[model samples]
Target: MTDFLDPVLTFIADNPSLAGLICFLAAMGEALFLIGLFVPTTVVLVGAGTLVGLGKLELMPLLIWTTLGATAGDAVSYWIGWKFKDTIKNIWPLYKYRSMIESGEEFFKRHGGKSVFIGRFVPGVKSVVPGIAGMVGMNFTRFSVVNVTSAVAWSIAHIAPGVIAGSALHAISQISVRLALVLGALLFIVFLSVMLGRWLILIILPLFPNAHAAIARWFSRRPDRISQWIGHNFDPAHPRSTGMLASTIILLVSMPAFFWLIGEVAPNEPMVRADLAILNLFDSLRTPLGDKIMVFMTTLGDGVVVTAVAVAVALYLFAKKAWRRGIGFVIAIAGTAIFVPLLKLMLHRSRPMELYTGADAYSFPSGHATLNAVLFGICAVLIAHERSRWAKAAIFSVTVTYVIAIGFSRIYLGAHWMSDVLAGLLFGTAIVSAFAFVFGPIHNEKIGRLTVAGIVCAVLAGFGGWHVHRSFDAALVTYAPQVHKEILQAADWRQTTWRSLPAQRIGLNGDAEEPLVIQYAGSLSDFAGLVEKDGWVRPPKWSLSTAGGFVEGETPPDSLPILPRSQNGRQPALVLIRNDPKTAKGGRWVLRLWPSRFEIMEGGTLEPLYVGSVVHEDILRPMGEFSGPKTDRDLPDADNNPARLVPGAVVRQRPGGTPVVLARRPEQPGLASQTGN
Candidate 1:
């Protein structure tokens, strides 16, 4: 593929809401700052980021939204610290993770707000850093300075890779069918990993809630063992270094390396979701700018994008004197960027398009999703330092919106399968969360606060966007007599809209005086069949009459896709309301009048049977008598222009009954249910 962004940019233009959401979610994955880059939301976030290249949506709007969200998320975390301070460790998840909190506290005391900056990367400290900063009562100016600076730099840092990838997707989309399968296999692997993660959470997480904690406990049990192991297996300083260099090395080196390995073995699924039908739909929209946008997005995606972002973030942190934090951001960014591509080349999996056409390659770890995920998650952790409630809420909301927006952009852009984005998000979140745990606050208070926060977040869902598709035309006829299933089994559902009789009659003996009016007002497509062959019409004396017409008026003509005109008798059709007369077979007629009507039994409903066809079919030959008004005074100009009548004109049949009138059926419910006619 020449570029990754080709599809991503197009998707952003078409699905702005989705773009906003992915960015928001990625930010929420963590608010700890650059350290948050460890979260897996890169796929989701970068996908949304790619939208910027499309040039349709302005970056300012999204930037404001995401920055605020990150700010808000971290702000709350900080408030929780200010409110309960050192006591928050008693909460459910936190209580179980007391050591992490203690680790954050001790780290904070020596490093001050710098720990908050550095804590953005340390898994345990990422979440607790803000809370710890708040507990220690750091100066508001210093905290905000660090918070906003980190938040802005972090967002760009995380989203850069995603935008790069989107730009490249264009060239990938141009390849032959052979490569498509390979891409598809890669997407499949990404999907598999996501499902595995989900299953792990659903099945294994609850069962082993303390896996990380247990490991910590295990290590605690044998301090000497941990030290010896650290010396043997990793940097000797990890267990004893003042910077926790030994633990850091083990975390940075071991687990991430394993994840990279997992990514290598994964397969791909190409074309992922951009189908020919969808491409055709857009092509028909006739906008040349469409392809242009895709091309721009895909080309921007490259490894250098990640590297540059990391370097920038490191520089910023160092400038701010948050040396440790600068180090963490550098480590996390460098690690993810290096590992993802290595795994891709190692696995050599094709994109979904490679396997099948238009698929992506080496997608086990979605880059876009991971980028935003890690950045946002880290930001959330850091935002916890903000003390203002409104401020925190606003930023938190915005961060989540961006994360979710970017996630959607990936799918809409057709750059990643649904699973790749989700798995990437989850994986990113896990990593950032690990950092948050190690460097976050130690809450040892009651569980009430955590419960309240959960409830509050859920309440926000109610106010979010709510939408659904609406389609009328209630029941579609899949089988009609006009194009009977005999020849084309698939030609059953015919769409029609006619205003005439539904049935017709032909008798040798009966006088034309009455015309044996069986029904009128709908259309004639079903006349010779249901009434003729189906059992609705009797054999001896009476028969039916019918014809056809058109429909009109709507909010907008193009609002609804036009139902195609009939060719070879297969077209869109409709049923007009009409009437029946002269004791027809429907529900055993009572002492009838000139026109007819019946109550037929369907399920438990004794519905009034006016003029309607059993099936939809094209109305042709507009020759037969028209279905009209019931009263003589309302008689339409039937003699002169009976084929097409005006609205509200009276239509009378010969003698007394109007041209269209009902012959009421007998009242017996049992007879209504049994009428074979």
Candidate 2:
């Protein structure tokens, strides 16, 4: 991926004029009527912003070109609408999107002059609003004023996120390239998911009214009692029909899936193996930062947090004197609370890790998962019951994302298996749906949806914050990775026992990575002292001051920080780097050491074993202004240099002819040196 991106970035840097032109065309294409629908202008514009942040492209020129292109595109669209106002509705492609045109017209009428500005940021209607305004003979002066200002705001809104992201990635790469990449991928995925969800909802929702009408027609044509009964209960004209039908469908689907999951988990089927595989995968990917994030997410779904929110919402509903609605809300929460524990008792499944004892150890249906799902699921239904399609889509999207995050946190933290979380979500959805279907639509007109939503959010922020702050430390300790230790006699380790250790670093996907080129039998401090004597220096730790070095672009190669790499989810304990000025662009040789599980027992004292790798990195200045390090694949010949510098250091060869460096602190005086291939 870096190989592919490097050349493109280089070309952009070499020809700034051409890059600006491309940005202009992309912005224009994305704003043009109908053509804008196919052009991925937002993504292209964001990419441009990223290049700016990377110092490959100047920001002001690109922003100016993009703004002009957008303004021109809107003007052209308005001209077309005005010229063909009488026949526009019957035009070939325009006729096909009659519904969108009509929707845009209605939006324009409702918001008046403001729609011209507001619609530029809205997804479905952004491309058509300008045309609609012209067709309706809106004041051209007003349109121009709104158009120019909105185009500027829209461009900034879309591009600023990318700029921030690029700047963040650049800083993080200095600490760990792998971490930067992981975080980048996660952010991109989240952005894509949100856009795709919104688009899907917008496209599919318009078809629902037609579908309901068709289904109603079909039922009318039929004479069967079952068809008549379903038609009457699900009639589109009825106030509560849509809610009842949707809830019933969800209940019917979720109940069976929940039972099937139970069956699969009980029999220890293929899903069980998959659960373990996923657990191991997450275990490998665990980092200190990731652990902290997952812990915070999991805490949001804790029993105390969810219960507090549920109780707050219930009280608010009762205060508004909405008796039936309050009762249904209570039933959904109470049912999930009861069902989760009952299932756990019946199945008695164990968590991936023994983080808890007694009743808390059982993990068939994750209480955290079930409680949060129930709380948010019902909240979405209640809030969206009387809202427009757009409001409903936004509400459900947020609710689903939150619930999924909580469930994933449980799995990532090793508190529950994947199947356990899945079962819990399915069961929780079933409970919420069943209650919605039985209770009909909630009516609390006196309490606005926004008011209810605001109260819930406020309580969650205030109460949940306190709970997490109190419990975060204990949660971290409980979820920390388990370590195992082994001891071997110093003589045995020197002879043959060393072969039992891992030969290569393991990646997140369980793939073999860099080979372990050196093994030292000494304390970390001793190893550091030996290497420091040879002119090796520890890289400066990451901080605001150090981060500024990347921007200065003149920091010596040796002063620049080295990116840390992980082996089996563990970061290096000791790192040292030495400048290599012989390379054309200047280079550096980095040495990193990770402590092993094994210890060498030398008489009364125990010396730890360390395994490490060495590599030479060449400086890369793609744009000549911002520089980064690029690692060379072939191992440098300096592999044995560190051990050679140590006093009384011994070297031996492994079976594959790779060299292993061995050393001991002079203070420990018990080892017999014996070496063989």
Candidate 3:
């Protein structure tokens, strides 16, 4: 819940590799004897499983890494026991947990090598069984067979409970409260399985000695069969051979399925709505600083930047004669570039309406996201082989952060939707994975080339940054003049009140009605002066009472002022208001304005609204009006007391203080006699 976790969760959601790495590390620590004693890895591994079931992680990688980690740890324990023999019993920690170690030894003696398989199910025994097996001179081949099989089963058993819990929670969240009962039932089953398995083994099984012996014999007879099966199917060269095979199989299966899912949903209306909701959320968080940061981050994924960096790195590799790596890099970048746009064209999904500043391309499978994954992800993969463990971790972390930041920038800047970014990441990762697998052994030892490449890339990156800034600035202006034109036309009475007064429920009788909406045709500063001169006062709080008072109504009004803006959550509405200048002198009106138009609301009627085209504000400028659709009520924050605005000047409040002032019209010369008030 800390601010720190937001980026961590976001990174986990965006990158599958990191999630797998975390699972592997947690499992390894959990299975290692000495470390397992100190590390409480259950919660960490279960949390990883929960992430998987919640759709934040891919299940295949999670299973592969966890199984591999657990298996490797067991192998190490077996080696330590074989080397140390009974001498390990004299170790300080072994002396402390003598009873548990003796129990493991007794169990191994009774069950022979089969104890390795059965012990994995028992918590305390699981930590000691592999060592006991090795200490008793069990064959390394036999120990490895049971170690791997049990590790797989153990990883699945422990992680599955969390997976089930997460899946049930996710399903219930999507469907209804009825499904919550199903979720509860699943959790109960997990609890029962954990407790019941132990009870049956440690208590009930002992009561029936014959049956227990029969089961032990059954496991004993299977070691040869299990070894033969493993020999026939699995290569023993790599420690992760089994997991690698599983990952490959899953990747092959998952890619087509994911592509099919994308094809099915890309054109749907619900998908558009989902994209809009996410875009709106990001839009609502747009502060001046955030906008600049996102814009800068977005440059990392820019087509120009990606191309320049890729080419520079590739050239450096070529100069160093690392042909395979250079070729893989090119293919990765080229493949992403080709496939992302191809998929976009095939889907033909239009970008969300909020993406108003220029990118008019099909929005599915974002080009920026795909390219970032290829560019940054390939760098991580290529460097991983040569770096130390700590260095690899740093490289991977930075890569994930860059990739995620670029993907996020796309969504934040309204260039792509959430799904588009997700799809792009998947596609890009697939490309990188394939490239790495094909050319993994290629090494670049030429430090000179690397240095030259880094310098070239640094310069190109600077140029890319400049290009992105100018491009984005140009894009904002591209739509500005046209948007301003539309606002002016919409604000004019001829197009607004003149044609739609009845629709707006203005006048009842068939009477000659004047076009009340005005095209203000002036700068914001000029409009501010006009409002002040016309006996209007801008109030700090925008409320129904103040708005209703403008039209002689009550707090819970019959009608409400319509402010058009994107509301993120329950933030306070920024309000400006003034008393009615004509027809109802005592009545107050809500003055709502955006970059396009300004409106005066008297009892929610279009009471002489104005629109202007002459003023050209920056697209990123924070207009007081809501940025998106109109809300039902533009309410004030309950916690924030109103601050009084000084007449004829902008209100300035000390850091945290309260001052209240009501709106009042300043006297004009002979105004009382002129207006007959």
Candidate 4:
């Protein structure tokens, strides 16, 4: 994965001009009427923004090209609409999509000229609004003005999120590359899951009538007792027949999966091995930022939040006189609540980490996962009961995303094993399906489906927010990474134990790269002071402002930010760089120090030990401009010599013959200092 991504990023960095061209094409395709419907413009523009944040692409040119392309596409669409006018309704492909045009016309009539601007952000409406405006004889001047302004806003809207995400990933990579990769994977999985749900619904929705007809026919051919019962309840003529059939299908699938999970989890079988592997992966990837995010996500599935939503939904249903639905909702929620605890007790399984005591410590089926699935699943069914196919698809997609996020958060936070969450989801799904099968297809109800949805969302946001705010700090402490300290005498570390530490720097993919040429046992402040006298200075941290240097022409070697490098999934604690006069265009000697697990007990203080690698970096110019700094793999022999930099530092040689510098701070009377290593 590292090998693949590194080359792709390098290619983008080498060809800055190609970035603008790709953005322009993506924006143009996304703005085109029919083509826009199929184009994945959001993903493309967002990817371009990520490159910008990663210092591979310049933001300004891409933004300009994207704006231009969007405006041009809209203008072309408007011209076609103006030229054809009402005749467009009879124009081959346009005639087949008349319904879309009608929808766009209605939106334009309702919002008038503002529709051109507003529709740019609305998915379906955005594709046809410009054409609708032109067909209705809107002035060209007004259309162009609105078109340009909205295009700019749309470009920013699409790109800003990716920029923020890329910046965050880059920062996290500076802490731990593995953690950053895990976070990126999570985001991608969530996105793919939601998209696949919507796509599946679109593909299957049109075939429902045929499937129903076939099933009805088959049941009529067989006069058995079971077939008779199914045919009677799931008759096509019945109002709730579709809901019942869907629930029955879900039951057929989920029940078996739920039982299978129980068998796998109870015996600590092959699935348990996978569970432990996933847990260990997450354990190694734990970061403070990731912990906070997972905590907030898990809090959304808290009993308080789920119960509040359940109560609100029940009240809405009953108040609207939908007695069957109200009863069914209560039954489903109650079933999940009762079964989760009972199953946990029956299995008596321990959690990956003990976040709570007593019954909470037992983890067989995750309560949070089960309860949230039941809550969201029931809500989706009720709200989508009488909606159009598109509406149903949207609801299902959102529900699936929420459920998956909450379930994954449990595994990521070590609150539950993967099997536990899987069991919870399957069991909760079964319960919801049973409820739907029993009480679905209400008739003559006075309920407003949209109102019910709004109420549920409001209660969740209100209660979930309050709960997270109150418990976040305590949750952080509970989820903090556990670090163990290993102490050694200063003499032992200098003499023999130094050999025990890693001799080479490990890359993000666990491949050995640079040699660990320096070991310092002292306060970082003292080490910094010593290095500063030798002409080494700290480079500015990477940020939006500093990133501008990449696109700027002829950035000085010393002024260029040193891109962070990770060793064994850990970033350096301290970084310093100094100019290399040997190169005419300019080069730099970069030093990165990472705190080792070993601590030296010297002069009654546990002094931190740091392992470091010094490598030379040369300026990279792409398209006749300074792009960024690239590390030179070949090391300069003189650069690794530490005697001239740190006085009294001992020079030792590893078996491989590479020199290692060991330095320590001078001892002070009656003073003891400790630092994390």
User: What are the lDDT scores of the predictions, listed in order?
Assistant: 0.41, 0.75, 0.54, 0.78
Q: After superposition, how far is residue 203 of candidate 1 from its true place, in Å?
A: 12
- The whole-model C-alpha lDDT of candidate 2 against the native structure comes to 0.75
Model 1 lDDT per residue over 373-486, tens place:
666555544444323433544454554555545554444344544545555666666666555445433232112323333332333232111110111111011100011111
Which window of 10 residues has the lowest lDDT sum in candidate 1? Answer: 467-476
Q: What is the overall TM-score of model 3 with all chains considered together?
A: 0.41
Q: What would the C-alpha RMSD of candidate 4 be, to one decimal place?
A: 9.9
Ten residues in sequence with the least summed lDDT for candidate 3: 612-621
Which of the numbered candidates is closest to the native, going by highest lDDT?
Answer: 4
For candidate 2, lDDT tens digit of each residue in 217-274? Answer: 6886689998886777677887777667668777998889999988887553657756
Ranking by TM-score: 2, 4, 3, 1
Tens-place lDDT per residue, model 3, 22-63, is 778777776665446555457667777776776778777788
Global lDDT of model 4:
0.78
Clashes of each: 212, 0, 8, 0
Alpha carbon lDDT of residue 640, candidate 4? 50
**Model 2 CA lDDT for position 665:** 69
**Model 1's TM-score against the true structure:** 0.32
Better of 2 and 4 by TM-score: 2
